[model samples]
Target: MEEKKMGLMKCLFVLFAGGVIFLLLLAIYPFWLLFAKVTNLIGVKGIRNTSGKLQTPVVFYEHSVTKRIVAFVAVIHIAEPAYYAAIQELIDSLKGYKILFEATGKLSPQEEQALTQKEKDISSQFDFIFDLMKKINELMSLQYQKDGLTYSASWINTDMRLYDLIRAFAQQDISLIKKGRDIDDPFTEEFGQTVARWFINKLFSRFIPVGVVLSVVAFFSRDKRVAKRLILDARNEIAFQGINEYLKDSDIVTIWGAAHLSGIEKCLKKSGFREVRREWFTAYTVRDYSLFDAIKKGMRATKEAASAATALKKD
Candidate 1:
């Protein structure tokens, strides 16, 4: 009888586990779609899904009358790193243009190559996407600095405290990884790992306090996977929110991760925008570090808009 009872309990446990997984899938599926829509509105494009008909990019060309509305979406990656200008080029080709402009941040071939390596090398895990970003930034800065140009940080914004914490956290994480420590390694008393973590979190907490808190939570919490997923979801929210806010007044042209951009076209129409456009802008081929020069040249256009006060002031 005890054996039979034990078997029944095992069955119940399995069923409960299956039910929980089902509920999670049900919640994440719709949310994934909702996120796609918002990301599409600003300029994420080229989405395909196995489950449903994906959204397409919107392009509006209005003239003289305000009746015309257009939202442009462009999905970008290492292959198509130059899509950041796709929408702007379209708008400029026309005469007497007035429209709202918004864009997701650019991901260059150099950055993409770093991300791919980080992803492929399970031995070297990364925290946030920006963790990889800082490495590529350093690499790019080196080339430029050697060429007699000084570069600050790409993560810089209005808040100095928050910016420092983010930079420090990124610095610590990247350095640790380069030293060959797996992400899952337990902290040792001799290593003073907690001090490093604390320095990063406390210093940068002002810029991204949520990120710092979550990092600390991940450090202490056992459910690190769930914490990571929550952080990613938060990043998606930030991208979507930033894109939405930018679209409110300008003709938006955005380039963000292709995975994130998928299925966002539908959201633009629902938001009262009309006629969106999307296309393949560029393709990225995987190469080595020596190819950094070509990749940097491809991404040099970022400097033009990167210096725009009007765009920077929006965020």
Candidate 2:
């Protein structure tokens, strides 16, 4: 009976795997057709090509909102050796200035207690995901630095904090995943690990790069209503610090995440600040390899985009 049961399990696994492969194969043609059509759009063409550099993805935009020029240096957080060094370098490079940082705000005692309970609840339901994120952040050095930054943090806004929204999203993700899962499934941890690995691999797949993901987020971020309000309050922080102090040569530098850059830039523009200088630096390394690989991929993508655009023009 045991042998028979084992055999039945093997057969079911094979059938499931085959079905998944078949669906993927069926998806390719439609995806290709869609990609072909999307290449013709004007702004999309610039993004699809090698116009951007291969770095950890940092932007240094100069804003003259105050009497002194303020440099809003936006960066995406990454947990890697080089990423840590790049952050330090950024801090070191901008000396003798009042630096305003994007800070996670203090939680009320009740909120803190609720968060603790949520952490416990999350561990019980999605231990694998929580543990993995924790490990990755630790490995990548992905936490805010107090001593390294050498500055007091300014809340992007007084009324809202980023962590509060993230907690809400965490609950939402938990609820969605739990509702979709089967009660009798025995491979809880293993299943979670498999899905996480597969999803990340798909993101880094040859056809769809991480840049494209960021571009999508950046595009939607233009709408303040749809995008998370956490980063949206960057304008508030700029105003709060900008109004607080000003000197003939004093510069207020804002070190925030790249995801918030576009929105922050838009807000700065509204406040009459113009971009005086811009520079890019690496923010995250997708692969644990040399930066050359990223550069080569960028070049290849640009070549492909250019060819696609030319073909569309001829048509």
Candidate 3:
């Protein structure tokens, strides 16, 4: 009887451990898949750490038949000012290339107001996302893409229109939105509202790192499949159409989000463009500063400011 009892206890312990492991794996599976997909699409050189600085790739592909060059300038929306400056300098150097950029073309005030109520709601949600991005920029001390990069009139915008995007989402019967609304029905409205308020408060906390906030947002995003399909896959097809039109005569330089690079690369390859060269640019560095180090840096800045003021007075 004692031996049987011991065996049963051991079995239970093993089962409990296995269950925990399974849960952890399940929780991380989506992120793991995303990482794997990115790696496979862009290779190990796509993103890397070089001496503590995170680097992103700028890849150049050459057409086999026409010999025209197509450069994919992968960019992070929020990054150091210097990184953007470096990218601008590179763009300036590519004098003859036709610039293609990603942007959801804007809607005029009249057009915006003309939108249906469902479309307006969808548009408002997008506005909320941009507002959230601005808050993140403030907390992270990073430059936004719009402020960092200058757009020339000659550059082509190869993305969907905002009005179309709003309409698309509005027309779709997205279960994620439906489910969230259902949670706010008379039965669970109060509890749902309380939970939402708590989440929003925590999400905007300064102490939370930008990366953690973004990761949490991505994890909890209602419908990843629908969002990715509309935002990424559809946009990629439009970009490819623009590239195809320009690649016949002009050398093309596409400045697009890093996530879109893989799709663009695949499209180029299918059209007989082979990657000729690749370069890595340092996007940002992770600095782990002690409290003393922070204080010393602050003191140095104060001294510099004083010196600048003294020079200005003298002049």
Better model by TM-score: candidate 2 vs candidate 3: 3
**Candidate 2 lDDT score relative to the true structure:** 0.48
Off by over 4 Å in 2: 1-20, 26-58, 62-67, 105-132, 138-227, 230-249, 286-315
Best by lDDT: 3
Residue 192, candidate 1: alpha-carbon lDDT: 28
Is 2 or 3 the stronger prediction by lDDT?
Answer: 3
Estimate the TM-score for candidate 3.
0.65
What C-alpha lDDT, on a 0 to 100 scale, does residue 162 get in candidate 2? 38
Q: Sorted on lDDT, highest at the top, how do the candidates line up?
A: 3, 2, 1
- Superposition error at 190 for model 1 (Å): 37
RMSD to truth, every model: 20.0, 14.2, 13.4
TM-score of each: 0.31, 0.52, 0.65
Rank by TM-score (best first): 3, 2, 1
Name the lDDT of candidate 1: 0.38
For all candidates, the clash counts are 25, 8, 0
Model 3: per-residue lDDT, tens digit, 250-280? 9999988877887878899999999999888
lDDT by residue (tens digit), candidate 1, 128-229? 343443433333231211122111232111111222223333433332233443322322321223333333223221222233345566676444544343
